[model samples]
Target: MPFYLEIIISVSLLTGGVFLLVGSYGLVRLPDIYMRLHSPTKASTLGITGVLIASMFFQSHLKGFLSIQELLITLFLFITAPVAANMIAKTALHHSNKPAEKTQNQALMDTIRDRESPPSNSIK
Candidate 1:
């Protein structure tokens, strides 16, 4: 309602919008599925968080209570975003069947796999 508060809300929304735009660009411009996730996971999260935090400021003064809806949404966003991204990547990996670039130590993996393999249960 106040002039200064209005300015603050406007600026906050602007910043959040900028972040959302950047994230959308990253989603479109990124080369690979893994890289594409940076757009929504990092950039969009910041954008939404910014907007929610700004909304809290705007609502608190009039309502006399800090609303938890925005806070809960932010929390859910943080929790779900990464899991969703991971599911996407994992599904891609499963469907593609092409091996990832073996940049890591193959020897290490071999050793670990040998250690972790289940013992042959049926002694045929």
Candidate 2:
């Protein structure tokens, strides 16, 4: 309703749109799976968070009360995005039948191998 609130919502929506676009572009243009994972996980999370914030602002301004659903969704997205990305990356590494040039990190390789193999010692 007010000029400043309208400006805030507009800016937030625009920023979210821009971040989402960048993430989409990265998914298409990046060379490898590992590189591609960074885009959607990081940028998209920020983008969604921004959009959700804008929604909360707009709704509160309209209804004269703060909305909780948008806050919850934003919180869920922030918590889950990185975890989902990690799982996808791990799955990719596991199923990569061919040696990928991009997967050169020795620590990651070691961690995946460790996860695959059974523990040597049993907890009696």
Best by lDDT: 2
lDDT of 2 by residue, 37-115 (tens): 8899988888988899899999998789998889999889888888999898788778763444765674666567567
Q: Which 10-residue span in candidate 1 carries the lowest summed lDDT?
A: 97-106
Lowest-sum lDDT 10-residue window in model 2: 97-106
The candidate that wins on TM-score is 2
**Model 2 off-target regions past 4 Å?**
97-111, 114-124
Count residue pairs with overlapping backbones in model 2.
0
| Candidate 1 lDDT tens digits, 27-113 | 998766657777999999999988997898788867988778888999999999999998876676545533336433435534443
> Each candidate's lDDT (Cα)?
0.79, 0.84
Model 2 gets an lDDT of 0.84
What are the clash counts of all predictions, listed in order?
A: 0, 0
